[model samples]
Target chain A: MNMSLKNTLKMAIKSILSNKMRTFLTMLGIIIGVFSVIVMVSMGQGATASVTQSIEGMGSNLLNITLTDRTIRFSNDNLSELSMLEGVHMLSPNINWVAPVKYGLNNEAGTSVVGVNENYMVINGYTMMTGRLINPLDIENRNKVVLLGSEVSESLFGQFNPIGESISLSGIKYTVVGVLEENENTLFGDNNNMVLVPYTTGMRQFRTNSIASITIQGTDAASIDKTQSKIETYLMTLYGTDTYRIFNQEQLLSTLNEITGVLTLLLGGIAGISLLVGGIGIMNIMLVTVSERTREIGVRKAIGARRSNILFQFLIESSVISGIGGIIGIMLGILVNRIISTAFEIPISASMQVILIAFLFSLFIGVFFGMYPANKASKLKPVDALRYE
Target chain B: MILLDKVTKTYIMGEIELTVLKGISIDVREGDFFSIIGPSGSGKSTLMNILGCLDVPTSGEYYLDGQEISTYSENDLAKIRNEKIGFIFQKFNLLPKLDAFENVELPLIYRGIKSKRRKEETEIALDSVGLYDRMHHKPNELSGGQQQRVAIARALVGNPSVLLADEPTGNLDTKSGNEVLDILESLNRKGRTIIVITHDFEVADRSKTEITLRDGIIVNRKVK
Candidate 1:
């Protein structure tokens, strides 16, 4: 509340306001820099939520197994024992391989050939757009029938119904049983693209016995922990090793969260570089201001303004600039998030803590970077300064 | 009262040494109207800078109101300038952003005077200079004569012991310059210790006492 400070602030504001275009152009660097940070961070957060929600949408009990320098073995002759274990609900075994699909003489596409039991649709929560899902009788008769993903079906059959149409999988012909509806998710998840086929038919067509993965559904929401433990114990005892990893719904959800967390940090750090550049721009402008206002500084000093008063004046000016930039950047970021959420169907949530953090960070940048110029201005001798032409 | 005992000041440019005031000394009592007249580069400005406590002599002693201020630090010198002396520059260095009242109230702000009392004192000072009606007008809106008057009001607001005028009329026309000189003479007549620095003999003749400098030395003195 010192008068010198009050006067100094008043004068600084008037000076900046008097030159509108120059002030706007000077603030442009901070605007772009802050805008880049806010937009990048918000978009990254939206993308992460999209990916996590997609993974969550895929049934919670899905578990993946990839063999890495270790052999996978199971002693159960049939799959009935796995179903009988405590807290065990149902098991859907899977086998996967790549195959080229053909619809007509010229239309062709490459897709993943997945071997799944009839319970695959039930455990994975997939709906059929046309025809029916895989059945036990089809597996028993070893029928040459396959289901296509929405994308795959559209690419191969066009507007014509693909329920009775014939398609090729690995040089073998199979009738199209159904096409699964497209699930809402991103490219980061595993269900975006694939072709589903009967287990026995897929084994005969590809000639391989390797089980790629197994998904076990829980009895109810309350029995998740029991089911996960039961599945892990049964698998360990059967295989005589605990090398295979077992995951339940909560673990899968947390894994997705962890990945998204890393992505958010990476994006935030990358955007922070631009904020640093903007801070440097402010510092550079302050140094020039100090040079141009040498005589003014002398006048103030001679008029009895303290050194700290001068420093605060410049610091406030820079902080005000950065503060305004932060405000505009936040608005722009929200606008971008809304547009993207509308363009592509997704959900985005921005937290108030993020805005507060960005504002405080910009203020810190102003003070930290403004130190050099403020000190340089404060150190100028009143005598030499006044004599300066 | 102000006293300067054998004061000497020197300047160094690159490697060469130049002395501006060589063992000059003077003393003046309070409420004295005095003029220091000299041509360009006669060390008058340098001596005025020292007398105003804006600069410390390289050697010898200076006393203001019986306090040895030659050894005072920069901060102490600033306090003395704020509390004891008011300066009027030739350029009428009013902050261009501020109006006449703000410029006049500046020293009171440094004196830590309360706002209400400071406003009262500022009004009185501006009215004394015939600028009370134009207190809100900025320097850009005022002519050279009016600006100098505002500057003089600014110097008088704090009721300092001495009013230091350094070529106060140098930048004004003949009529405006005479107006400023008349104001200075009136302030001096009111028993304020007023010291003016000028090269115009006519302006110097208006003061009660005139001290002339030649080659950095005081050569003649006349009492009007």
Candidate 2:
């Protein structure tokens, strides 16, 4: 008989609604399957995004050089020679130490102190919010002038301008010459929490003649590789050992991307196993539904329902179950992602493509798993089915 | 019109061969009301099933309106059942999930009738069976007689050439049974062919013609 698809869908929905608990129980598996996949992929995407942002925060055409051998120090003449190297656009020698600072009644314990030259602000992508940055005179004369990060200034002098104010650091008095801008896209926490001083003053106070690290920007994006290899060869010859590591922004970003990509796929694969289980659950429930509705099948057949009609009816029913489950799962996945991102303070990126793929997979699972039961229903003999209690 | 020529049905259980109908022949004309009466295991149900196109005989030449349906494929027989035969079961097999209107509309839906025409035909069929007032009531909410009437409406809604009822009043009270028999008689009078299968003589007596079956053969045939 020529049964309309609309009528079959109506019948399927009616039957599904008639058994609410069974339908819900069957849908639970699919819901969980879709939920886990979305959540895992979203979190993975978030991690990848965070890593990319951090790598990009280091400056696009910048390279980092950390000296593992403390004995090898870059002298002022050596720094000038390296600065004039081909493909090197700008260079900043830096040192780091931790010391306590006190301004009036506000005291910061173990505050990070960074020693840098005039090129520090340019290479590190820092902008001035209020005062000028440290000049070359500050480094040349070993002047005891310091620049406070935005956060350090806020903590030391709330609502009051701290420029030109004198603060004691490690029992030595220093004047605050400037306050750096508050960078919102800082990779590792707030860069606004540290103090910046001249490398000469930091070297004398910390009792160190060795430079801690060097940051350099290439003349252009294409020149970064040449500059990086030149510096690596120079440092290797000077130290006579491979005691330093050089990393560029592109290398770090690509490595992070690869790691996150593999992690995302692994997580999605684990969740896919649950989806398979969910498909099996649907098949199990569909088989039971067919068996339970055998008499109804017989009645429909006797009323002139063709085998195709019965097959389509059952197939639509299972698809509706999974389709609804997929929708709910998508919503639940978004909600769970929001909750997790908020709780952990991580940025989650749940793309539209992921949601669409998850939904389509659920539908496919429904059709794939539903085939056997629908075929079984269609192959039933009217007489035997009618006789089935 | 229905014609059966030397129709035989057999069932093989392990090493035993059980023949239910041994070359039984029967002819039912248009606008005729007939009853087939038999005791249990007399092959009357088997014959009803074959006539309703619910089963194919082991060997036979069964014709409905000059079509050789005994040799038709399963799908073809299903189409014939959909277009030419309407069935009423003894237990009032109205889908419990559907109301009376939907139950009656089932056959029309299978026929791919549009909703507007299907609703109109369903209403007319329910009105004819006197269940129009209870058309919105589900099977469980209706009395046994009302459910049977709804089943009859479902059978009549398709406008089939033959109405084959298998003990239509078997599960009803005497008053309800008589009401169903009266409806069948009235439908027959309206130029609709009706066949009732029952072992009860009282039920058989309501029909204009009666055939009694014994051991897979017709023992008696009477026309009143």
C-alpha TM-score for every candidate? 0.73, 0.74
lDDT of 2 by residue, A1-389 (tens): 48778888889899999999999999999999999999999988898898888777777688878877766777777687778888889888877889999997899998989889999998888888787888999988999999998888999999898988999889899999888888774544568888999998989998986785888888887778888888877777777667887868888778879999999989988998898899899999999999999999999899898899999999999988998888898899999999998998998957999999999999999999999999999999999999899
Against the native complex, each candidate's DockQ, computed on alpha carbons, is 0.26, 0.57
lDDT of 1: 0.79
Regions of model 1 farther than 4 Å from truth: A1-6, A59-123, A127-213, A216-242, A247-291, A329-373, B65-67, B109-118, B189-191, B202-210, B218-224
User: Which residue pairs in model 1 clash with each other?
Assistant: none
lDDT of 1 by residue, A1-389 (tens): 24555665666687667667766766666666666666667767777777666666766555544333257643224366777867667777777788888877635455877888898888778888888988998888889999988878877877888898888876788999898888665333546467899887887778876564666776665677777677667666656555776655667667777888788778878878888888898899889888988887776666666666678778877777777777777777678777877887766645676777777887777788888898888877777777766
Candidate 2 per-residue lDDT over residues B1-224, each given as its tens digit: 79999999999999999999999889999998989999999999999999999999999799999988888887887788888999999988889999999999998888888999998999999999998899999999999999999999999998999999999989999999999999999999999999999989999988888999988999999988
Q: Which segments of candidate 2 are over 4 A away from where they belong?
A: A59-252
Given candidate 2, what's the lDDT at residue A299?
Answer: 93
- What value of lDDT does candidate 2 attain over all alpha carbons? 0.89
